[model samples]
Structures are given as C-alpha cells and as structure tokens.
Target: MEYSKDDLIEAKRQIDSTLHKLKETVKTLESKENVSRLKSQITLAKRRIKAFEIANYFLENEIKKDK
Candidate 1:
C-alpha cells in the first residue's frame, strides 16, 4: 500500500493530464460528430484517473499510519 513520493507525484500528474484531456474533449464535443469516440475515451480516462487518485490517497494514508 505504501508509495514513494515519486509515485504520488506521478499519480497527481496523471490526474491533471486526464482532467486537461477531459476539458479538451468537452470543447470538442460541441463541434464534431467524429469526436464522440474520442470523447468517450477521455471520459473513461477521467474515471480511471479519479479512481487512481482516490486509491492513492487512501494508500498514502495507510502508509503514514504504518509509520
């Protein structure tokens, strides 16, 4: 359950990237039919990144508790 500081940093970066992609996807959604699949992909990426962030938080807490 323990993660290094680097792991936490990476997780945060990934979450940020996913959020950015989601924003771009939303902007595209209003403009193009061809982008629906890309939008769906970004939506799933957002969900996954969210889950990763939540899990990373809990795991980090657990690591701190163990210390």
Candidate 2:
C-alpha cells in the first residue's frame, strides 16, 4: 500500500511514541525484584522495539526523499 507523506509522518510519530514506552517498560521490568519472571515479556518488548525502530528508520528515509 502506498502511504501519503502525511500518513508516513504520522506513523513515524506513533512509532516513536511506542518506542519510548517500550524502552521504559524494559527498564522497569529489568529493575523488578523478580527479573526472571518477566524475562519473556521483556524479550518480547525488546523485539517489538527493534521492529519499530526499523520501521521508523524506513519512514524517516521515505519522508526525507519526499522532501
């Protein structure tokens, strides 16, 4: 699907926001007394954060090219 420049920008903004929250979650999870209990959730969040980061990078490049 072809996304308009504005749509891409909006997606990038949302991804950035989610990335921030995911990082905070990872930090909080790691600081918990029972880190092992939340290992899977932490790992999942980290993976999702990585995926979003890649998407954000692509969106940024697309936006730059659209300029």
TM-scores of all candidate predictions against the true structure: 0.49, 0.96
Candidate 1 lDDT tens digits, 22-52: 5666566646777756776757756765776
Instruction: Give the residue spans of candidate 2 off by over 4 A.
Output: none
Cα lDDT listed for each candidate: 0.65, 0.96
lDDT of 1 at 35: 71
Per-residue lDDT tens digits of candidate 2, residues 1-67? 8889999999999999999999999999999998999999999999999999999999999999999
Q: Judge candidate 1 against the unseen true structure and give its global Cα lDDT, from 0 to 1.
A: 0.65
**Backbone collision tally, model 2:** 0
TM-score for predicted model 1 compared with the true structure = 0.49
Candidate 1 off by > 4 Å:
1-34
lDDT assessment of candidate 2: 0.96
Residue 38, candidate 2: alpha-carbon lDDT: 96
